[model samples]
Target: MANTTALLFFSLAAFAACSPSTCTFIPSTNATTTNYPGSSFIKTSAYPYNISVLSEVPIATICTSPTGNRTAELACARIYIDAIDEQLAFLYARRLGYAAVAGASKFATNTSLNDPSRNDVVAAGMAAKVLKYGATEAAGAVMGGEGCMIYAALKYEVETIQEECNNKFTVDVERVCK
Candidate 1:
């Protein structure tokens, strides 16, 4: 009886040690000041990475200008898009690390590989939330019809990041783990 109890305790301890680690995605925050007055509409800091994106024209001006200036509109889009790209890249790397841990745990225990779709779902969801929040913030800063351009650009950027998330976590995780 004592030997069986000892074996049971050991199994529980080993299982606890082998549990998978959790992955978290924290969204970036907007900074209050822009170095150039008219250059950027929104400035955000990608924490831990020390990266930031700044718009070229004040978002209000871009929205209110009678003639839709493609140059200014693209410039504003570029900053937020760039920020989204950087943030996604950071999150991807972190997700890869988590996948590696899970993979290693499976291998150590001689367990069948678990489906990676779960991780992909989580990564994609987080990426969508981050990009959407950034876009919403940018659109909120402009009044009336002016926000259309920003929204359009943001939509494209979001699609691009979502694709990237699918490729990175879904496809890449399998390759890395195998």
Candidate 2:
């Protein structure tokens, strides 16, 4: 149990340190209207990513308490951060000009990764893992001790989402589509 926890903690830290840029959210103006100010309209042509599915992991596994019960608190903090991050990313993306469509319907058929919620869900799961493994093992405690990892993950994810949106907007919509 101790070894497993330690491994999880180290892995989360390594991921955070090495993959910081993967999830930063940059502002994009490719999809926006007066209906909202901080919202942008994302068009099909505005999507900059080459869309990949990556790996699949269950949210329950991450959010639920393991043998140590540290994950419950981590899940709470993660959910809070997820709400803030998702809202911010959507608002920022909309503000930058990306419009929100329900999914990959005709309206968003051309959009890359039509579901913003997908990212949030994944982030929430990641937060759970970080809390489960990193917070508990590193601190030998739960809840209060896990706060730092949550904050770190939150900061990293938000920044990555924003960066991705901004970079896409700049390249596809502002530069090419304009």
Candidate 3:
């Protein structure tokens, strides 16, 4: 009975350790209500602030050449630039009160892409077409493929932000873009 109890406890502990929990990317909006003696109604508002979290950008390094240093240097430079662009986008999203999603969707969407299915469907279709039809096209094909991702992200940002705004709120994309 003692051995069985110990085993059960250990199993439970292990299970708890491995359990997945929901993590909030955005901070909670709950705020304490303030009331004035003169006012009959109470004020309900969250803190006058926005919270944002960004992912760590990886650094580029020169590694010993497996296929000439030129290839490695170009590859490293490309990854470094990509990381810089990703960080810039993260900052922009955070400034606009958007939470970054994990995986390819993060890069592929303008604003969490609204529909999760859209991310997968679009990515799969684009990747397949690139592989099948654009295999010989090389540079042009790559640019076209990347263009699709930008289009998806732009669409998401426009739709999601518009949907999130209050009826009275007015958004000036031009101002924001500036």
Candidate 4:
């Protein structure tokens, strides 16, 4: 448990500490673990925020990483920053991001494969959590083919911050991502 916290601090600190020169080329052997935050992040803003929880950034923020290292993590800081100013705004951004991406996906667009199957219903039907995961995987495949550190971190940040938004008020998939 202590080890995990230290690692988190190290990774984030390394990222914070990284400078243009210090953050050089990461080799191909960087970590590929993809255990990012799931979709239940709406809990962060659900409960009360008092001194009792002041020391924490919401336990929901502690995502489950499969197995990662500092190499990719630190590099992520250079590319993406996820410190949204407002919680509801965070959720809105996520919903919009997912909708925009899903709408433009090859399966959703007729311009890509020349196919007529615009399966946007899939996106609309997905639960809030499913939307987050699918978008990360889809974005990662398109953006992280090289397994670059920046892209990996982008995926992680995207998932992590999206977990910190307001829940849909209920898990009814119908009204969740809608």
- lDDT, candidate 4, equals 0.33
On residues 55-106, what C-alpha lDDT tens digit does candidate 3 reach at each position?
2333343334666778777776765565455445544444333332331233
Q: Which is the leading candidate under TM-score?
A: 1
Backbone clash count, each prediction separately: 4, 38, 2, 1
Off by over 4 Å in 1: 1-66, 116-178
The candidate, 1 or 2, that scores higher on lDDT is 1
RMSD for each model, in Å, please? 14.3, 24.2, 20.5, 23.7
Task: Report the lDDT tens digits of candidate 4 across residue range 45-150.
Answer: 3332331222533443233234665555555432222322233344434544454343233222223321112223333333333446555544433332223322
Clashing pairs in 1: 39-55, 39-56, 39-57, 40-55
Assess every candidate by TM-score. 0.34, 0.19, 0.23, 0.18
What's the best-to-worst order under TM-score? Answer: 1, 3, 2, 4
- Candidate 1 residue 24 Cα shift, in angstroms, is 24
lDDT of 1: 0.40
List lDDT for all candidates, in order.
0.40, 0.38, 0.40, 0.33
